[model samples]
Target: MDAVEIKGPAAAFGPRHEDINEDANRFGDRYSIRFVGKDKVCTNLKYKDKHSSVSKDVSKEWCDGCPERDGCAYFEPFNQIKNKTRSLTAPHNYLEIFPDILDQWGDIEVVLIDETPWYNIFEKTARIGAHDISHTRSALRKLDDEDKADSDVIKRALSLLDTLSAGLSDKDGGERQADRAYELATSIDFDELTTELTKIHDGRVLEGTDYTDAIVAIADNLTEIKQTARWASDQGIIGEFDSPPEQLWGVDNSTKDNAKFELRWRNVDLMEIARQKPVFVLATEMPTESVEAMFDLPVVTVEDTVTPEAEIIQLNSRMAGITRLRKRNQTFDNLVEFTRSLFGSRLLVR
Candidate 1:
């Protein structure tokens, strides 16, 4: 008899084809933003002296789903890491400066390097990827009386969202980050989210967080479900399989050509960003280290504060597009400066 070999148990595969979109920016001007969001690793939670989530209110009027809802009503979760203050990973916090960008460049092409997939996940959850204020805010409008009136929890959550949205409605209000985060949190069908995806999602740690893990769980496992349903329809002929197929778990299949059932929202956002690549990207958080090894362009690090600044690639008929990159050694002084640097020092705000 011949010996037989078998494969390991089925799990999420890898080598995902990331960033299918074309690159808009040329070489030599690309810059990477480090430590952009407010998270535990970025903020030294073990050390109490440098914490920024400090507030006397000690109330949770803000949605518990919000990272900043910890000790006060300030938007964006405050992260303390070894005596460092981290800002919110909320894309809205980063995008609030868009009006200024529009005022300064007046429709200039730009790219925002989103360092983490969480931002993308939030946006896809409700077509509010990158924290597009209007779409995210509108998610609340869809809530029926069951969500608003019957559920006190949802009512409070929505109230906080309304308040934050109003504050950021006109100018970049102080509470916009909080409001934007709320929008992102509410974007997903929390009830449907699966534990696998939620575990990796940064926001899942937040208390009272909504879940959409269940929604994509069955859908991603469509093949397996179909098989089961088909068998049921065919009068139960095949009981050969013991468990649900690997397609069900929509988690950690990072490799390219990895086919698994994915949530519709994530796919939507991914394609949208791919189509509209901006030249200069201002990222709120630092991207994964794998970014350098995987991509064609190098990540250039700049020593600046406030906002993430990159060279604007000029589209000239005669000259080829240019790209510049920096090292990861440089550092920005404060969170405010680094965040502001994304907007750059320029003209009008209108």
Candidate 2:
């Protein structure tokens, strides 16, 4: 881990994991937080991609208008994170921030998962409706009229919208039609469009005006579709979109005029991406069988010897799944009373 000194809000933990401190990363007597630099602290993808070498302005741009800025105590006027920090304090959703973690970190030596990483890895689905595209086109026109957004960028985006409208036309098989749309989606100059739209969004957010909403909506939709295409292509199952066949993509034709397109990827080999590093998951409750099923890997359980003072109870009853417990109020009330009688005011029903 690159060890660098960081100051101000740029060094603070993100909102969800702010409770964490240097103590949480203590390995024996050594603290790992000292290695976590600015790139890891900032969730901005643009900054993380370049590591510490990325411009400080990237972090400033995000923090300047961040909704979470007001709640953080370490807020600083400038970002102090440096590139290639040796250690990182990442959240449960670090995969979202560092999708290419293995590439950047080069085969993780060890990972102490605070909880189960049993969630879906790379599988995702994104959709947008025809009307949403229509609204985006109109919004872009409005922005152009007001000189609030770049006319060239707006024009290109509007043209892409037209391409999507044409691509979505029902003229062939579902797979062929979807492929046509996906091709159009992937052909976008994503970096250029995203950067321009993000600038507009940052400015618009400050003004409390959602003039960029429709444009943002379409951009988000296309980004998702592009991601789905990449993952599907990587797995060599791009054309197999049918659920029974491969579950990669789908078209929602329920609405005649406002049809939606959904794209999905079933699974990704988490270990393959991690370079087969040993993953030690810590959890209060985790199903080994579930983990094995999703990851296709063997799991060994290690139970703590220290026992809790609280009495443990397990109920094997279908009554909890009953459709309407209200109809059997007496039965439910009796169970509650029995528990309350045993525990007094300490009983908590959740």
- The digit string of per-residue lDDT tens for model 1 on 70-96 reads 553223212231123211112322342
Compared with the true structure, all predictions reach lDDT values of 0.29, 0.45
Best by TM-score: 2
Best by lDDT: 2
For model 2, residues 277-297, the per-residue Cα lDDT tens digits are: 444455424445544443456
User: Which ten-residue region of model 1 has the weakest summed lDDT?
Assistant: 6-15
Q: Identify the runs in model 2 with alpha carbons over 4 angstroms from their true place.
A: 1-91, 98-109, 112-119, 123-135, 143-180, 186-195, 209-277, 281-350
lDDT of 2: 0.45
lDDT, residue 73, candidate 2: 34
